[model samples]
Target: MKFTNGYWMNRPEYDVESPMETYDARQDEKKLIAFAPFKRVLTRGDQLNLGATTMTFTSPVENVIGVKLEHFDSENHGPSFKVNNLDPDVAIQIDDNTASLTSGQLKVSLPLRTDFDLKFTVDGKLITESAQKAQGVIFNHDTKVSYMREQLSMGIDEKIYGLGERFGNFVKNGQSIDIWNQDCGTGSEQAYKNIPFYISSNGYGVFVDEPQRVSFEVGSENVDRVQFSTEGQSLQYYVIYGPTPKEVLHRYTQLTGAINLPPAWSFGLWLSTSFTTDYSESTVLKFIDGMKEHHIPLDVFHFDCFWQKGFEWCTLAWDKEMFPDPVGLLEKIHNRGVKVCVWLNPYIAQKSSLFVEAKEKGYLIKRQNGDVWQWDLWQAGNGFVDFTNPDAVAWYQSKLKELLNMGVDCFKTDFGERIPVDDVKFFDGSNPKQEHNYYTLQYNKAVYEAIKDVKGSEEAVVFARSATVGSQSYPVHWGGDCLSNYNSMRDSLRGGLSFLLSGFGFWSHDIGGFEDGADRPTPDLYKRWTQFGLLSSHSRYHGSNVYRVPWNFDEEAVANTKRFVDLKLSLMPYLYTQAAHSAHYGNPLMRPMFLEFSEDPNVFDNSTQYMFGSQLLVAPIFNESGRGHYYLPGGKWTSLLDGKVYSVPLAGQWVDEEYDELSLPVLVRENTILIRNEKADHASYDYTKDVDIHLYQLSDGKVTTKVVDLHGDDVATVTAKRKASKISVNTTGISGSVNVYVHSDNNITSARLVDGVAEIDL
Candidate 1:
């Protein structure tokens, strides 16, 4: 996608034409359009042959600007992204030489009569801009049509992040990233989910609103610019402005879509049959029985690919060889208070009976020559289901409807990536190149809609493996296959964080890694990963050839797994409420440190550390020694392991005490009101009764309030305020023991606190 040999020379076959000056500006209602000529027009004769690009600038919603630059305006690509039309909230003022528009806190000013430049200023200071040869149209003779692209300016020290579940480096500064979804595992540069959005450290973000393939060069092709191009004549992108990182996400989610909150039990521990591992009703029963015997909490059980026979993937039939009695097995598994998730893929193998039916009915993707498209990549004669066809979607869902009728609670929708790219045609006549990456969105949408129909809106879920721009609307997604090692574990975390920044609410990874064969993850790695995994939005045990049962590693792995699962169950009141918040608002369940502590510079690029909810901080051990160094933002953090307090002031660092395989680092920030369920036995326990709100390091003069779900009706709000000599407690829908822990510069002589009420004296 890189078209430049250097600054002065273009690639051999591509011709680049950049806008030189603004010829005329037009305004209609609230929309502003700037006509820019590719060549300099100083005279009337210069305007005669104005065969140049036209850049149209408008505001879709407040604080979000959409820029569409078109070389040829005749192409009409249907099935655009679902952008809701909201009334614009910006005021526009245009004059002869200068034009300025304001939306929320974002102001865009253009020097109309001068050089064509775009200045995006938030809070009256320029964060970045599109200057010089930034906006353009490129023509490649090797392709059928010309393309348009936009290159926005970047700061010298700015670090780019996001672009959807990237497994590459955490910072995407000098990388050539294509927003094309592929079924690559966690160890490769290819990503399962490739969103055309990136946020920089300089406080602004650009989201290419196309569901199709959008290529981005983040300071790679051009060191000082972030260039993005599409394969067609028109390129449309949105610049979302945020005064802070959280606000940026707020704006971005408002534009794309917000995620629905997954079910409460879905947040707990999920056990899976390792990929390609032989398992039947007896094997699954033994694993469940063994976990119960070891006191490990397991909420959901998943069946990987081998659940169906090898050549009949989309048959949705239980392999008679392995699971002959799927109905009875499902009933038995559900009888043990566990949910069931079966794996599924979009590809229908030629051997599958459904494939022949689909081919006869024209329900499969076709080539340019109007033949069914087939590939031999993961499976022989694999034909992709054409999600663009409504009848095809219904046919695919009918297959799933049969499984759902047999008590399959959820689905791990895998491999929507690796879609056919060349000479292929969608039923709706969507551009094949555009459909290459956007197909996953349609695939997930169909599956999600089917589950929503069967399980009701709030109960449906998918452990999806691939995604695109608006795929966050689906509930749960997991990190793709990864090797079972410490480095892979770190990369998994980085990938999840990247996805989180891209507006995904829930995500998980295979617990001790996926592809470890001979040199498997040690018991140390299992225990360490168990702690981190259990703290995730969803926890699952999956591997390629090996079993991920805790006992397979060691006794310590079993014990540690039990400990963390129990801890998560104990903290259900906190985690469930956070999950609800994620569903209602688009904030992620697991957040990077910078999302919570945006004002602190130390939290940037701190992938080794993350916030479990709003209060708990977890820093997993990257090495086998279990020694982890992390930054705690200026507070007195109390260890959740032993209740030991450590002071961190003046933006410095802290090292956790030697955390062996049995334990990892967990800290609660100061002034946090930790909410937990009173009972930790059941995943679906009533969170309202006898809940404990443990107050940590209560700083004087600040009001601390926390919210927790009271039954399914109302959320209990608890507020506590501490003054010089007394602390006042108030509650809205809660009646429980509020344990107020006094810490740091407090002179309380006597503490006589009672359940549901408290009074402290100095």
Candidate 2:
């Protein structure tokens, strides 16, 4: 993807043509067009053999401008992303030297003369511009291939983030990234989900509209420019403007799609059968009973790949040898208030009984020679299901419907990253390169729809692995395979935070890691990871070749796991509200510290600590000694574990705190109200009953907070105001009884019950 040898020269066998000047500028009702030639015209005779590139600028919606540069025009490739744009009317003004197009608060100016330069502004303030050699059409003369690339100027203090769930450094400066989905583990630069979208700290975002491979060089290929390119004759990108980073994400998600709200029960702890480990109905029951005996809360139990017989993955039939009575086992688990999730992939092996039928019905991906594509990787002679065909999607959904009829609650849709690209054909004739990353979107959608059809819309969820740009429409996705170590654990957090910035709302990772059974995770690592996992939006304990049962490590691990699980259940009232916000708006549950503290430069590269919700900040312990270094932005923060108070300075300071294995650093922001349910023993409970509202450092202002029930409906609203020594509380839309507590420095100074309205003395 890199074509330059240095700043002064290009690599061999490459010819890069940049727009030297704009020869002509014209305006229509909706767009502005400019013709830029690679070489400048000295006279009218010089235009005889010269070719020019057409540059078009238009606004798709308010505050969003789309730039398309083309050398050759062709029909748009099929299977484009589903984008709904609110195109408002725009006015184009042309003069002798400048041509300006204004839409809403955004204005784009282009030079009417020969010089090709573009300047973008919002509300009369400069945002960014494309100038100099920012736009180019490169040709590889050796292979006779060409590409189009565009670079946007970055501000001097700007930092770029969010290029999908990246495991590298948090700041993307000086990094070369490729948006190609792969099966690499969480420890590498390769990512399972590659989204061609990035937001800058300077309050603007850029999105490449290509579903195929898009390469980005963030201040690497060129120091002051963020370059993105695709292998085609045309390139299209959108510049979305926002005054803040949070607003940028809102606009970006509005352009794509927002995350769907997951069911309340899906927020609790999920225990999975370790991959490649031996597990039967008895083993699963023992694990469930062990959780109960240890006083650990359990919600969903997932059966990994071995649920189906070997070499017959995705058969949709239980392996009778391991699970003799699958129906009876599911009934028993359901009676214990647990939901069941089975693992499935889109690949069907030749040994599967349905393979012959799939091949006959053209439900599998085929080669150009009219034979079903076959390979031997995870399974023997596996063929991928073609989701492009409507019939194929129906056939696959029907298989999952049978499992639903037998009492399956959800599915873990995995392994969409290993799709074959070359010599294969889709049923709808989609480009193979684009389908490689987009296949997961269709695959997860089919399964998710099937679940919604069986279990209503509000109860549908899926644990997906691979994703592309629009795959955020799926409810929950987890970090893919990782090794059992401290480094892997830290990388997993980095990946998750990066994913949240890319517009994914819910994500999880293996509690004790997923690989390296010979050298299992240490007891300290398990205890530390347990704390972080249980606090995630969706928690799951899973591993490979080794059981993830808490007791398998040590008794202290069991106690630590139970403690955190209970703490999470206690915070359900607050967590579920945050989840609903993520679904309704585009805010993320797990946010990087900079998202909340945008003015503090210290948090720009800080990935170790994150804002759990709007009110709480969590710094996870990574080392064995339980010592962590985190920065607190200037605020009056109070510790949630103990009633300890810390007043941070205006410049923001770092604190290195030592914690026991039982706890980490969780701090509540000042002047915030957090709602909790103390009487709930499970994740899916009546959040309206016996609610406790904890008021933190009410500094003479009015603060209002609302709580939602199991169906995500508003059940209660509490408004509290402080006027010197007295706090007035009022409630409306109350579903059940509520109690209020006033805390100054994490101590409840006064308590009262809500009887229409109440007042407490501080």
Give the winner by TM-score. Answer: 2
Predicted model with the maximum lDDT: 2
lDDT of 1 at 559: 88
Which parts of model 2 have CA positions greater than 4 angstroms off?
Answer: 735-737
Clashes in model 1: which pairs? 261-583
lDDT tens per residue, model 2, 708-759: 8878777778888999999998877654567777778646865656574778
- TM-score of model 1 (CA atoms): 0.96
lDDT of all predictions: 0.81, 0.87
Residue 322 shift from truth in candidate 1, angstroms: 2.9
lDDT of 1 by residue, 198-315 (tens): 8878777888977777889999998999998887778888888876666677777878887777777787789988887788888999999899999887899999998988988877
